[model samples]
Target: MKFSITTLSALLLVSAASVAQADSYADAIKSWCGGLAVTAPKTSTVVVAGAKTKITVTRKADERTKTITGLDLYSVSKDGKAKYVQNVWKGNYALKSSATISDAVPKNVPAGLYYYRVWVTNLIGKQHGPDCLETSRTFKVTTGSHTNAAGDLEYTESLHDNSIYNPEHEVGCFGLSVDYPKAGDTFKLNQHIHIQANRDAASQTDALTKVELYKGDQLINTAWTGSESFQNSFSLKDHLVLDNADTTSDYHYKIHATSKKADKTCVFKSGDFKISN
Candidate 1:
């Protein structure tokens, strides 16, 4: 899945006259502007079946104070089909709030290419404006679980259509990446394996709470932990020793991160490789 940030920004900048010309739910949401800005995911995301995925709606206000009154989610398929998923929230919610909201992808949603959009209604001094925003890129829902060489469950993300294993940049509020052990690189037993996690720079008011490393389902190490603010790019590193692994099996490293700004925890898995005896 991929998100086009430029396209979304262009949609938000549509003139009121153009917005008025359309009569769709999306157009209606785009028509009103009371100085409330909504930011969605900046990159493609992937979630497994039956797993809870978070969708965070970040709001910025202008001179007028705005209160979020309602929130809804819609799913869009590859064939341009749109369906209402559910009402995420209703009633008055505060602005500039760091509260994280989340919902699970319907267990029945088949494995395929799809994207979600969030519609928000806000009140600015009795005036109501409903604005719509979508995930910058499409996301994937996989029915199969990913496992490592040890046959343990592993964290995973959708690869680009071209099958390239690149780190997700700016998922919701912050970006995550693995710098070392480029996907599919093999190593020898007893060789010191160093893993690195990088968080891209962001302009949101949020903090990264944790960065952890995993080998299959086993917790290898906790790289960093704290309420670290996201202002600049930073990296965390950890060393691993595979003493009990067999050379015939495939292996991979998975990075997990938690951020208050995101509705769901960020996860990215490395490409499969092996340990040569």
Candidate 2:
């Protein structure tokens, strides 16, 4: 969905000078044509996949405004490039108006942070102002069901229930276990913590790249097979010990894993397990 420079220039009345003239591209577009203002989702909107997003846009095509013949919606890329994701609205003749664009986020869209912008196209089908309102013009996608091949993570204190700990009763590297940590499951400081990454039965070929424990954004510990991938299932049995000076706060530990079969490099996080002294 990458737009060509020529097409973009023609659509957005952006001159090479405007791009080079200002350090901030958005500011340059604003200077060029005052910019079309997007007035919905004042904050960073969370767009769950397969859901409808109601977007409201307004543009004034007067002497003070740039001629807006058409309106386009684009998702901004990591490299600060705009990729046309959807055409929210269009006009055969340029006029001043306001419209609400209801766009359905694709069910299979990748889970990550996304930013969208409205591009105003001129009478000749040339696009103008790449108006991305404000610095916080972004949205988020939580989980894509299609990419979530790994099952939910599990935890148990009983070795009998989790045969992976019992050498004689072990089934493969890890055994079939249940009694995963519930929403209110909490662990004591310095207690034996056992969590298992339930490999998707359908994704037996996918390699378990790594398993990590995190407290908020800080990494607590990690376990990964050296150069090889864990064949099917993996288990992490470690003592839950908070830093000596961090006794006052009850922190929640998060488990994340990377799967080769899912082709996802970004770690997929599971539910949080509370920890306390």
Candidate 3:
């Protein structure tokens, strides 16, 4: 999903009903949401379904009126334009306060800063709440993140590249690990980037020569010419993103690796996985 970056301050939430009541809404967020922690996908870079995200909202009685409509995600760049990020999870609009929403990464989401806006929406646009009572959480997506794994090659998401494969800039630049994600662990696609062929693939001196993520036969995503290296520690923050997978299926990733002489294409499958929203 296309996205921008922004910091959310005092949230003035208005419901789908355009009536901003001048009444004191209790601190339902802390009351019902106290001690609530989300089981975030490891490494932040995750696949759409592989994203291990879970929220533990406390069960409270006063949190009756507050409604959690949509669980939004984004790819931010430290700017104020944090609204364009794609939404992976959209909670039930009329659900009560004690409701807990969960969803994997969205299929069509691009790379950028992501946030979760707890508010209502009408036919027009997003409804603003009376105060910033709506809870907002923020995260970023350079390559992406999710939880669990299937076999190993679960190419769930992918994006395009501009360099290596010009005939199809779509498949040349970036690759996603899984097109069909699993139930456990976190999976994510690389960002939209250009592939870089290395003069040498060893010595732990050069950056990533080539990066490609894929599904079974379908190419999920591909990217090259990264700015960092994964020789000792593989960092997903330096790659682009690509996502196109189901959150509940068992899947893995086939990271295509290339060196000076031999080109290594690694395929990873998953074990037993699941996805529920």
Candidate 4:
């Protein structure tokens, strides 16, 4: 069908106006969303294990109908890899001007490197909008063994001496803790001992290259390999059986790990244990 020139011109004007209206609406939505700002616990702050810490952040959105959803912690490796540790707080609270969230570092969280991030859910009309995230700077977690005059644990920043801080290495074990066979514990011969190590919040890119059992200077057996190793918890009971032949001396285990991104290998050793016939 043929259309008059005036009719076609009117249609074009209407289409152009529609496009401009849509663009304006998009810009308005973008402006409605807010940017989160973290002001406290500055970068490179040292946090003690088993201690309480506070985070302060402000929402800068034009809309004030936002809810603080979560405050989460993450473990960061030297190779710039991050893994979620735990949720310090998870709830819905109407945010006014700013808020201070408090959470204690888990006592069992091994001394390592970590950081915190805040999650906020914005309210668009009556529905919840997408979650917004603002990550804080990296922090250090110390063992917190020493105390000052007030009995508060004294925290001193550690030097970068290990693989975790080494520039040449891309991967390293953060908090390698043995779960079984405490030091000085004795196990009966022919007993099945479950050997396990917890690689606390290590990066997913890192893999266990070697897990070996040792007695003195001699190597006993390779417990697990990176190709078949567990990600967070390394356990190998089927390959580790205490026999009469293993009762000659004190025993220990070693773990070696590597990341695909680096050439350096991370090593960890367990305390001495014993086996008796």
Candidate 5:
């Protein structure tokens, strides 16, 4: 399945909707701020399913110290559907700048794209401000059981960081045609990337292997093998074309490998890299 990032405008609308709902309840109370503002999370986040994520909510205050009573967290799906997951925090707290809360992703959460937003309430007044809501950038949740006994894997820009293969030890490696891009490498427009993964299977029909290249939750490229497997090993490669119009920003990449058979499925993920664009 493919994934897409939620746009900033859409997130704002989602936040507004949350505040609108909260406002209806706030109107019944006497002590409620006319407006409230919150800042969204800085960047997209990725977490393993069934894990706890630390979420910080910054309430934009003008002069007075705002007393935060509680914060409600909401989860949104890839199809632009949103639901109230739970209240992460419920207590009296003063927010000079911001407050943080912890939320746990349910163990049964399906592996897919999701986003989160926060809504705050006043402790003393018991009022929820319609304007005090912020939606975070799109995030991803990966299933935790993607382990198999295929073999350990590695990636290299060239033959630089490679060791001589021994039948008793290492099984395979991946390589990129371009220089090993660092975490924050900047690239000019019109640049592109090419990568390949080479691995040896136990037998010709032992495993069905596939390689995936992702930019955040979105799957950019995939390379897979059929029922036929290499007697010793096989390789998969692909290229990614860069955009030209956007010059001030960089692009991040993550590579993952998966092998599946009738019996089981295994997965490996590489650290993220960045390219200037």
Candidate 6:
């Protein structure tokens, strides 16, 4: 909520010299031109324990490469200086030449240890070698709290789900859960983790999407699911925040669900859950 380190270091030096220079890499796609792939805000090291986090960056455009004429972006990080990235066609999604792009990797993220780089050239523009990649695992989203045997204190969140979804033709499965913080343990964040996907029930049946909230694996906050059909109605994970927390820290959460059906948001979700901070 504050920025001055020379305006975030001149926003990382005009985003790493504006993508180093852009010659090929589909002109470092801001839109059309084409070329970019690497599913997720993770190129390698990705470990999230909880507090609202979902960073995906999968965009593929190289059927001949060129035809976007609008919207495009993909960049992850580990201090991804190419100017602290994240641009996924804020307008929705665009880019030609055999097209392919996945968005939604920006939601109150603030833990350290990261790495990633992608390139395209139009819509949001910036191409060439930024096509870099690095991150075989080094992601954090800390926060912790656990003591539920009736001891109360049950504010938790744990991530690492890789469930690619599709149903029959795109069979991928990995699920997880440990949600129960409807509100109590000192919170002031407002709210953003109120999930209810997969079946979209009003009573209950594990339809808590994945609101997000953690300390040990670090993901400061996130509980907004107004769209994406309730953010996918529960596929990979993310969209539930009822526990409510913010004091000193509390954790003991582990809910990892993966399958992504086929990639709705599959960074790592094949099933996960644990809450004991």
> Where in model 3 is the C-alpha error above 4 Å?
1-52, 55-60, 63-65, 78-80, 87-98, 107-112, 120-133, 140-277
Higher-scoring candidate on lDDT, 3 or 4: 4
Per-residue lDDT tens digits for candidate 4, residues 142-242, read: 76657779997655535354544333222333445566656887766545566676755434224567778789878877765644333366555523354
The number of the candidate with the highest TM-score is 4
Whole-model lDDT, model 4 = 0.62
Question: After superposing candidate 5, which stretches have Cα over 4 Å from the reference?
Answer: 1-43, 122-131, 145-277
Error of 4 at 213 (Å): 42
Per-residue lDDT of candidate 6, residues 116-197 (tens digit): 3333333233333222221111233323447889797543343332221112211222222223333233323322222222
Residue 205 lDDT (model 6) = 21
Q: Can you write out model 5's per-residue Cα lDDT over 128-202, one digit (the tens) per residue?
A: 343334444434555564433686332221112122211111111111111234445454433443333233221
lDDT of 3: 0.34
Candidate 4 residue pairs that clash: none
Q: Which 10-residue span in candidate 1 carries the lowest summed lDDT? A: 162-171
In model 4, which runs have C-alpha deviations exceeding 4 angstroms?
1-33, 145-277
Tell me the alpha-carbon RMSD of every candidate. Answer: 17.1, 21.3, 22.2, 19.6, 21.0, 19.7
Q: Candidate 3 — number of clashing residue pairs?
A: 97
Displacement of the residue 104 alpha carbon in candidate 1, Å: 1.4
Worst 10 residues of 4 by lDDT: 164-173
- Order of the predicted models by TM-score, top scorer first: 4, 1, 5, 2, 3, 6
What are the lDDT figures for the candidates, one per model? 0.49, 0.43, 0.34, 0.62, 0.42, 0.32
Runs of candidate 6 exceeding 4 Å displacement: 1-36, 39-112, 117-182, 185-256, 259-277
TM-score for each model: 0.40, 0.32, 0.28, 0.45, 0.35, 0.21
Show pairs that collide, candidate 5.
186-276, 187-276
